[model samples]
Target chain A: MELVVSQLLTGLSIASILMLVALGLAVIYGVTGVINLAHGEFVMLGAYCAWFLQTEFGLGLIASLVPIFIVLALFGWIIEALVIRHLYNRPLDTILATWGIGVMAQQAVRLMAGGELRYVEMPAALSSSVNIFGATESAYRLFILGLALSLFALTWYIYRHTAFGLKLRAITQNRDIASSFGINSGRVYRATFAYGAGIAGLAGALVSPLKSVSPEMGTTYVVDAFMVVVLGGTQSLFGTVASSGILGELSGFLAFHSNDTIAKALVLLAIVILIRFRPQGLFAARVRT
Target chain B: MNLTGKSAQQTLLYGAFCVAILLVPLFLDDAFLLNKYSRYLVFAMLAVALSLSWGYAGILNLGQATTFGLGSYCMAMALKLGTVPVHTGSDGLPDFMVWNNVTELPWFWAPFHSMAFALMAGILVPAAFAALLGWFMFRGRITGVYAAIITLAAMVVVNLVIIDQQRFTGGFNGITDLAQFEVAGLAFDAYSSSTYYLVAFCLSAVLLLSLAITRSKTGMILQAIRDQEDRVRFFGYDVALYKIFVFAVSAGIAGLAGMLYTIVMEFASPTFLGVPLSLSVVIWVAVGGRQSLLGAAIGALIVTGVQGALSESETFLESWMLIMGGLFVLVVLFLPKGIAGAFEMLAALFLRRSAAKVPSVSQPAGEAITHGEGAS
Candidate 1:
């Protein structure tokens, strides 16, 4: 019972991180219809952003979140306007182009930061382990779990109620009609791209404490996040939520019996097989063409 | 059929290129340089294989190296089995198996002992996997972005398996210290200049095979399918079979390159099957001009040669990747058709200036259209 409980907690904590990463991915892919191969790099940049702020300015991790979002969103806006905007109508070039951008970003980071792994010291308040129901776990893990759920709730509310959300959805539903209805798709796209990037940045900020910060760190997470988003269905938020949780839990449980690398490989294989059966993913019906 | 004026020009250019390749060893007397050039040829084969699928068939397969790596390891294993130690108690037990404390030879390692089987398996393994994969992806109507993602995921899975099974697969160090590549009582020594001929001869053969395929009626139909699949289906063609065929054949070609790579590089490692190599091969194709097989091969040779030169020199080694990344971006954005495309444009312009009323690019009506690829 203790082992199961501990594993479940581990699963939930991992799921929370996957959720944050996939949330940004799902939104970007949904609105822009881009796989955004560089989305992972955005997360990597976010982690570096947090490390930079904490070291340069002595700001706490919590204090850096807002600034990280703003900076990352601004950075995203520049990239979209300059590069992504030109390639929006040309989908295949976007993949090739974004992959180039991803490589450049990774190399740029490597140049700036060097290749060694860096650690972000966990805050003292959240450093201890907490016992619950005879199972002991890190306080930070629990904090992340709560933080992730709250963020999801906030995102859901904004997505459902905000004017920006409506505008974005309108464009996604029918780009031409929405433009006819006086929606500035260009503005929505820029804003949507910014928002998605901002979310990825924040996820990176939160993730920095848990994993070692490196240029290539985003590669695995991004791939995993893509699996979550792809397995969840391309355009469904609920699907992202459901699939992230299921995959995270399944991977966490499998890791308990086997090793982490094998567990990861198995989970990825399962997702590939699952994709074979339900290419629409876990939630949505086939996209009516 | 008799060749048209444009085709005659293309043939002339191709002959000149092959002659140039044949004469490379004479200009460069250094055995090391000859070996280096041969490795480039192997990579050129990889690039040409990618051009067939991505350029003509419009598959954009992101895992070409997976097939390449599999073939390399297949050849490596067979060669290693031949060098089994006398005191290992069992015949044909690879050194790694002894080091890992395995008492018996694995069943799969058995057939590799026979030279014919190993040579056949080296080509067949990757092709068969691709055929199976292509069937699943194409017949199920899972294509475009999904196909790309699925193939990449499968590659990751296979890579992990190779890494995890350290005892059998040599972990990350990979199968090294491979024996000399021998064929019918003849040895292709790594240090010998003749080894360069072995690779160059095979490369031209593969290149010729690809050119023949692209010119054939089946090649025309494949291009048509790439342009408009639904229309082709309406014309009573089996679309999936053609896709599977091209994909499998492309894999087979990559496998052949992988075998050559094993000989040139003298070892097989996990990096050959990894994402970085796979992506680099795709970029080589993109930079070469995917629409032209010969151009793609040249692209690989040029880009890899430049990369090699830059990476080897101490001043630029650290910054080479960054520059390459920048070049990659510039190519994808501005030079989508690549160096070959630029040359063709220049040639057409010169022709136009010389002959006032001549038509440019006299591709047949049936062979003209090719759609820019995308799922969205």
Candidate 2:
């Protein structure tokens, strides 16, 4: 029972990180209809930014979140304005374009930081494990789990209730109609994209301490993020949350039974089968075509 | 008569291309350059396969490398079986397997001992896999980005499996120290002029066969489907069948290329099945005119050539990746049709001028759309 609890906690922590990464992807994809292949590069950029701040400026990872988010979000906005904005009508081109952008970003980082893995120092307070339900668990993992769930709640609240969410939804439904209603669809799109990018930046900053910070680190995470986005209906925030938990736990459970690579292969095979059966994913999005 | 007149420019260009490919050995007699050029043709074959599926049929398979790697491994296994034990003294089980402590050869590796079976299996396996993938994806109407993602994820799984199952598949090092290619009494040595000719012959034959297919009625239907799939489906054509056919043909071509790659390079590794290689094929196809078979082939040759040349230079090595990325972006941004498209435009202009010189032109510009895609 204790082992199961610990495994669940581990899975939840993994799900939390996945949630952070996929949230931004889901946000951008839902609103703008652009599947950003460069999303992983943005995550990598965020990790680098966090690493730079923590090492050069001696800032704590906890202290670097807001600034990193703001910076990367603005950068994402600029990218949206420059490239993604033009390719809105062409979905296939968006994949190719973002792929180019991802490649450029990856190479740029490699040139600057070099390919060596950089480490982020975890905060002293959360480094140690604490007893929970008669099982030892890392405090950092618990904190991350809490952070992930709360962020999901916060995102859900903002998306479902706020005025910005209203405008975003209106534009997503019908661009011309939304514009006629005095909502600047362009600005709304840019903002939504930036917000999504910001959330991705937050994901990178948080995950930096847990994993090795390298230029290619984001690629691994992005694949998982994409799976989450696909498995969770693209337009649904709640679906993203639910799918992340399910996939995270599935991989965690499998990994516990087998080796890591085998577990991943199994999870991927499961996803392939799931997608074959239900391409719309686990939850259907309630949207007007 | 109308077809002959329309394809006059195309016929001339194709003849020149064939001559150019055939004459490379005469211009560069160095054995090293001959081998490199042969490898370029292999890459072009991959690009052509990609164009058939992605450009003509509009099915972007992101896991093309999976089929390619599988094919190469098949050929490698067969060739590995031909040779007796190097150090094993354990009755010919492949050096890596012997190293991994396998005394007896596995059943799966038994059939590859026959050259003909290995060759057939190389093409058949990838084609069958593609057909299965197509049945699931196309039949279910899972087109566009979802199809691409599924293929990509599937490939990653295959890559991990190969790497993880090292004892059977040679793990990360892959099947190395491969035996020389021999059939009956003929030895297709990598550095030999005959080997280069063999590759050239294969490349040319595949190119011609592909051209014939793309020019046929089915090819027209595939392109029509690419433009407006729903319209084609509404017209009572089985969209899934056409897609599956083109996808399988594409996979077969890629598998053929992979087999050639193994023969030329003398090894097959997990990286052959990697996402990066798959993406590079996309890049090559996109950069060459995705819709043009010849363009895609040329694009692969140029891109691979440039990469090889740049990576070797001291000053350009570090910036090579940046240049490639920049080229990819610029092509996507301004030149979506690619360099081949530009060449086509120039050819069209020349044809237009020539037509003006002789006023009695029977065929109208309506056939230009069909014949114009022939090549530059």
Candidate 3:
């Protein structure tokens, strides 16, 4: 019972991170119809921002999060305007273009940061452990979980209740019709892409303390986040949450029994098999074309 | 095969290319330079393989390195067994296996003891895997970005599994200190002129064979499918079968290249299956012009040669990736047809200018040129 309880908690913590990383990908892809392969680089840039701020200006991770988000969002906005705007209709080309952006970003970071592993100190307030139902848990982990859920709630409210989201939805449904209805789809897409990038930056800043900070670190996170988004169904936000939870638990349980690398391989295999059977994904929203 | 003027020009190009490759050793006396060129030849084969599926069939396989790595490992395992007693010991197990406390040779490594078996497995295994994967993906109707993501995911899975199974696969350090490739009684040293000739010969054969495939009737149908899949299906073509066949064929070529890569490099590492290498292959093909087999091959050679030269300098080494990245972006945006496409455009312009002097002679030729452009 104790093992199961602890395992569940661990799974939730993992799920929170997955959710945070994937939320931006889900938003950008769902709305813009661009894969944004540079999404991972955005995460890497966010982590670098946190490291730079903490070391250079004595800013804490928590304090630097907002600035990191803004910086990444602005960067994303410029990329979209310069590159993605031209290739919106060509999905495959966008993948290649964004990948080029990602490679450039990674190399730029390597040149700037000297290719060494940089560390960020965890916040002192969340450094302690908390007793939860007889299983000791890191307060930081719980905080991440809380923050993830609140972010998801905030996103949902904005998506479902806001006028801007209504325009976004209209554009998603039919770009021609949305424009006829006076919605500036290009502007909405830029904003959506930027927002997604900002969230991804936040995820990177948050995850830096848990994992080592390096230019290559984003590659793993991006792949993992892609799996979560792909498995959850491309268009469903709630699906992203549920699928992340499922994958996190599965990986945590497998890692417990075996090891990290093996667990990762197994989880990838499972996702591949699952997608083979259900290509539309676990929670595909029913919509008529 | 069609004795058209364009076809004649293409044939002349191929012949010139073959002669240039064969005559390299006569011009360059340095063994080290010859070996480097040999490696570049292998990369050219890989680019040609990618061009077959990505350029012709419109299947962008992001995991091209997965097949290449598999083939390399298969060949490496055989060579590892043939290494000197100092590395493998009298028992014939690889040194890493002994280090990992693996007392016996794994079952998979058993067949690789024979050079013939390893060579065949190098090509066949990756081809078989690609056939199965292509079948699965095409049957499911997974196209575009989904296919790219799945293949990328598969590559990562394979990479992780190989790294995790340290005892059998040598983990991160990989299989090293491989013996020279020997067939019958002749040994092919890595830096020898003989090895260079072997690579050049194989590359020419692959290039010619691929050109033949691209010109065949089936090739026409494949191009039709690439342009309009639904229309081709409507015309009674088995779209999935065609995709699988081309994908498998491409993988087989990549596997052959991988074996040659192992021969040239003298070792195999997990980096062979890494994302960066795989992505780099796509960049090479795209930069060369994915629609032209020879163009793509030449693109790989030029890019790789430039990279090697640039890596010699300290500042260039630091910013080579950034430059490549910028090149990739500029190529995709402004030069989507690549260098080959640009060359074709220039040739067409010259032809049109000469034809303008005699309007009657240019009519049918102009139509032909436009027809070829439309097909691409």
| Strongest candidate by lDDT | 3
Determine which window of 10 residues in candidate 1 chain A has minimal summed lDDT.
A270-279
DockQ of each: 0.49, 0.46, 0.53
Best of the candidates, TM-score: 3
Candidate 3 clash pair list: none
lDDT of 2 by residue, B1-376 (tens): 2677756756566567767888778777788888998998899999999999998988888788989998999998998888777877757778888788887888899998899999999999989988887888888777877788777877887888999988889999998888898877899989867778878888887887888888899999999888778889999999999999999999999999999999999999999998778878989989999988889989999999988888888767887767777788778777878888889777667777787766535346636643433211
What C-alpha lDDT, on a 0 to 100 scale, does residue B301 get in candidate 2? Answer: 93
Better candidate number, 2 or 3, judged by lDDT: 3
Q: Give the TM-score of each candidate.
A: 0.94, 0.94, 0.96
Candidate 3 lDDT, B198-250, residue by residue in tens: 99999999999989998998898888777777788899989989999999999
1 or 3, greater by TM-score: 3
Candidate 1 Cα outliers beyond 4 Å, as residue runs: A285-287, B1-3, B84-92, B357-376
How would you encode candidate 2's per-residue C-alpha lDDT over A19-87 as one tens digit per residue? 989999988998898888889989999999999998799999888989999999998999898888877
> Per-residue lDDT of B1-376 in model 1, one digit per residue for the tens?
2368777777777777787888888888888888889999899999999999888887888789989999998888877776746557656577777789987888898887887888898899999989988877787666666677667766766787898888889989898878888889998887667888887887788888888898888898898787777888899999889999999999999998998888888889998988778878878988999889899999999999998988888857777767777787788777878888888778767877797666645534413442333323
lDDT of 1 at B281: 88
